[model samples]
Target: MENQRGKGLSFARRIYRPRIIGLGIGAISVFATLYPLDLPNWTWALLVFNGLVWPHLAYQLSTRSAFPYQAERRNLLYDSLMGGFWTATMQFNPLPAVTILSMMAMNNVAAGGLRLFIRGSLSQFAGVLLSWALFGASFNTQITALQIYACLPMLTLYPLAVGIVCYRLAIKLSEHKRALSALSRTDSLTGLLNHGSWKDLLHIKFHKCQQRQMEASIALIDIDHFKAINDTYGHIIGDTVLRHLSSELRRNLRHDDLAGRYGGDEFCVILPRMSQSQALDVMERLRQIFSQYRHPQVPELKVSLSIGLAAFSPDFQDPSSWLNAADKALYLAKNGGRNQTANNAGKSHFEQTQMA
Candidate 1:
């Protein structure tokens, strides 16, 4: 209910300025038609109120209502009714009447689509009938030059106001779309790329490396004894440990490098334009920094990483082959000792670097 009310308030605000512009301009068109007829004092007063006061009144009514959206819709119907009443008061002067009615129809359709258009048209018809009963039915189809000039502002300015509102709405929607797309591509826990997005980026990186013969490397990292940590402490502490490693990776890696959470306690990184030795140094520093971190909540907790490094080689067939080479190096790092970095370089034998 709160969300609905918020949306309703927003809807009312969006309509407020356009309503003011349309009605202020519309009054001129109606006045040109009614001037020759010499309507009563009360009718002139009503016209003044409608032209100058009603827009603000409608905004206040909708904004303060419990159901603001519904209130705004009611206000739109009132506008349609007033438009019909004015058209009849002019005895259906062709140019001014058609301009007023057409603009009201445009507003109804824009505000609430076909459903509101239908309802507003019915309200307008009722107003026409009320005017006929009070003033007697009469028709004056002639349109003077003065009436045409008066209608001009309503025709031009009202649509311009509506267009500006629509343009702003489109821009906001586009920004929201971009934000949602970013959220979908990101991991909730670590703020890194999720598994699928990371893999997609890896494929692009692999192709770039293969085509240009560029020196780049990939790393697969595991939180050492993560399951044991979770078992001893809790999943919460384990999550903290994972987030710590991700923070360390973000801080240590270059801006161009890509890191992603590769499911569970494992993470993957892409080091573009870097040799195997450079990649190893970067990963080793990250491992050392992370190993020394002490969780404030669990002061007894200590963490370490086992990382695997693989440089892009021409002998690799696909992105999967490159990934598998890194996986093999990770395995060697894990088997040799838990806290170290190892390089496979598309070879059977691994070159392992154990952290002291």
Candidate 2:
């Protein structure tokens, strides 16, 4: 269910923002009609500021030239100036200025929250609400009772709608982004994470072990004679074998366990908070599971796996070293015989093979 939902969110990211743009245009049109060209000088200036100048300035200061986080900050500056100008205009002609400012706030919240959704940040709405509140407070501070009472309701209503729309949009975008990220990091054919995920996971685990003195073991598992399975039984059946193991490994392992496709017919597992002996037991269980199963197409799908595991230690300062030691153990397993498990607690007295 979770994976299906993630896929659906991925589909939504491609469609949501462009749809919001149409809504934005309609909102802007309404704002323009409410504050026509007949307004007083102060009101005219405020309309131009909020309707055109602010967005243009925000684009100039932001967009392509600055980093995302930096651009978000610059947006606040532009919004503040626009909101201030709009608030002063509201005292002169309270109705139109309020509507224009509301439109601006709504647009900001929409765009900022959408961008934030993609980038995995949540603080973008701060500018929208803050600017609205600043304008509202400034109006209340300077105006007499009649104007204040007339404008305050419009002030609250517009910002509230903007906030709500933006809030919902932000959540949708966030979910979509997360799902896309997950998809990018995982293998499409099998459920396991991909090569990129493996590299990233290794780096993260190594850093954790360095900082906290945690024990970690990694298993490199390869289906023995996988090429023969593909050549003899056809690639379709071979793919089925790989898919089946991926499901089995994911089901068998603990929640903290991570399995990734290292390459063709090869998979790697990172087991946090586990000793070398424990890793071997897990590998042995995998061997038994594959042995017990048979493929209908091949009939004799007696495929065996070779596993090489290594415990992360101080000498394993780099990710390459851990992989090297694990690969060496793997080589020994393949050399001695197929269907065996090997592990190194630290650097073995023998040699460790360097991996490409």
Candidate 3:
């Protein structure tokens, strides 16, 4: 029911403003033709009611309907009916009749595309037949100067209103598309890039370093004893610890650094334009920062990180090979001790900076 109302409001807003503008202009267009014929008093009153009051009444009817979009669509068909009636009553005067029918068609198309256009056209035909039966059918091709002036507002202003509405809707759709793209690439738990997005970035970074002959490093990080933490304090507390590590990474890492949740209890990072030594320093800082975090929910609890560092190399065949090096280094860190940073290159001793 709420959803229906939301749709109704959206339909109402789209139709209301334009109807007000179009009908106000339409009134002028129709009156110019009718005035010369010296329409009967009741006929004149009906024309004024339709031109001035019907727009507002139609808006109210559609908005209050259970299905607003469908209601607005019906209103558009009625507009076509009224347009045909006016055209026939004016004896098919070329300028005013054309303006009325064309504007009605435009409204129907805007509301429901080609299907509505056909349906509304049929409704207009029915209205023309009814008017012919009641008031006699005729044609007046001549359009006076006053009628032409009245037609100008409908021709120019209504199209502008339609264009403005369409432009604003396009902008809103573009923004929604961008937001959905970001959400797809991001992890809901840690607010970091998800596994697939991270891997794609790694592939891009790998080729970049190869072409530019520039230095960069990759690190794979694990939360030491993560399963044990979950066992001791439940998965909720374990999640808190993971979030803490992610927050620390955001605070310590450079703006250009890319970090992502690789999988359960593990994260990956790419440090661009940085050597092995700089990478190790950054990882070491991250490990220390994570170890110092004491959860407010469990004040006695502590967490630590085990990190592996690997530099981009000409010898590596692909991004997977570089990732393998970091994984191997991470294995060494866990084996050497639960909480330490390890570098896979050359004879660099495993940094045994463990925290209790």
Candidate 4:
């Protein structure tokens, strides 16, 4: 309920400024038309209330309602009705009547598209009939010079207010789109790139290497005995360990490097422009540092990494072949011992002695 109220309040505020600008200018036009004829004291008072007080009241009505959007739509219909009442009361004066009706129609369309525009027209017809019954259906065809000048402010400023509202809405929509795109690409647990996005990046990187004949490598890293850790320390601590590892990877890797969670207990990295030997050194260092990571929550628990490195090869027909080589090397590293770095250069496997 609180969240709904907040949204209501926000919606009210977004509509408030435009309503003020539009109605304030409209009030001037209506007052000019009303001033020429001698209307009753209560009628003038009603005009004042509509122009000066109604905008704020309508905003409050919408914000305080259970469904703000619906309340605001009703308010817009009320605005259209008022426009009609004033038009009829002015005796259909050419300038003010047209100006008022056009502005109200614009507001209706902006508020709820064609459907609300038609609904507002019906309300306006009702107001016209009410005015005819009350005031005996008068007509004043003449549009005095003062009234034309009065109508100018509504013609100019109301459109500007509507434009500003539309621009602000566009900006908010763009921001939402960007935020959603980032969320889709990111891993929920570790905040790394998820498996599919990482794979997409790997494909791009493979193409880049093939085109430029540049040296690059990919590493598949696994947390050794991760299931045992989760079973012993609980999944919560295991999650903490994963988060810590991702943090370390973020801290240690270069800005250009890409790291991703390639599913449970395994992460992937792309090392561009690095030779096989350089990739080995980097992976070895990462393994050493990760093996030394001590969780604050469980200080006695020790964590280690088993990583597999595979340099890019022209013999590979596709990105998956390159990835498969890294996966095989990762298997070897896991099989050799719990903590080590194993390398696969072309078809040959290196000894799993790269350990700290």
Best by TM-score: 1
Which residue runs of candidate 3 sit more than 4 Å off their true CA positions?
346-356
- lDDT, ranked from best to worst: 1, 4, 3, 2
Per-residue alpha-carbon lDDT of candidate 3 for residues 1-356, written as tens digits (9 for 90 to 100) = 88988977797888888888888889888888889885668878878888889999999998888888788888888888888888898899998898889888988887789999999999999889878987788888988999999999999999998888888778988999999999999999999999999999999999999999999999999998899999999999998888878888899998889999999999999999999988988888788778888887789887888888899999999999999999988888888776888877622234333221
Clashes of 3: 0
Q: Each candidate: what lDDT?
A: 0.91, 0.65, 0.87, 0.88
Model 1: C-alpha RMSD to truth?
A: 2.4
The true-versus-predicted C-alpha distance at residue 216 of model 4, in Å, is 1.9
TM-score of each: 0.93, 0.59, 0.92, 0.93
Report per-prediction Cα RMSD to one decimal: 2.4, 12.8, 2.8, 2.5
Better of 3 and 4 by TM-score: 4
lDDT of 3 at 337: 71
Per-residue lDDT of 194-287 in model 2, one digit per residue for the tens? 9988889899998998899899899888899999999988899989999988988988899989999999999999999887767777888887
What's each prediction's clash count? 0, 0, 0, 0
Q: Candidate 4: which stretches are off by over 4 Å?
A: 1-3, 346-356
Tens digit of per-residue lDDT, candidate 4, span 1-356? 77877776776787888988888889999888889788889888888888889999999899878888778888888888888898899999998898889888987887778999999999998889888888879999988889989999999999999989988988998999999998999999999999999999999999999999999999999999999999999999999999988998898888899999999999999999998888888878888888888878788999889888899999989999999999998888888765877778422234433332
Alpha carbon lDDT of residue 306, candidate 3?
84
List clashing residue pairs in candidate 2: none
Cα shift from native, residue 42, model 1 (Å)? 1.7
- The per-residue C-alpha lDDT of model 3 at residue 75 equals 89
RMSD of 4: 2.5
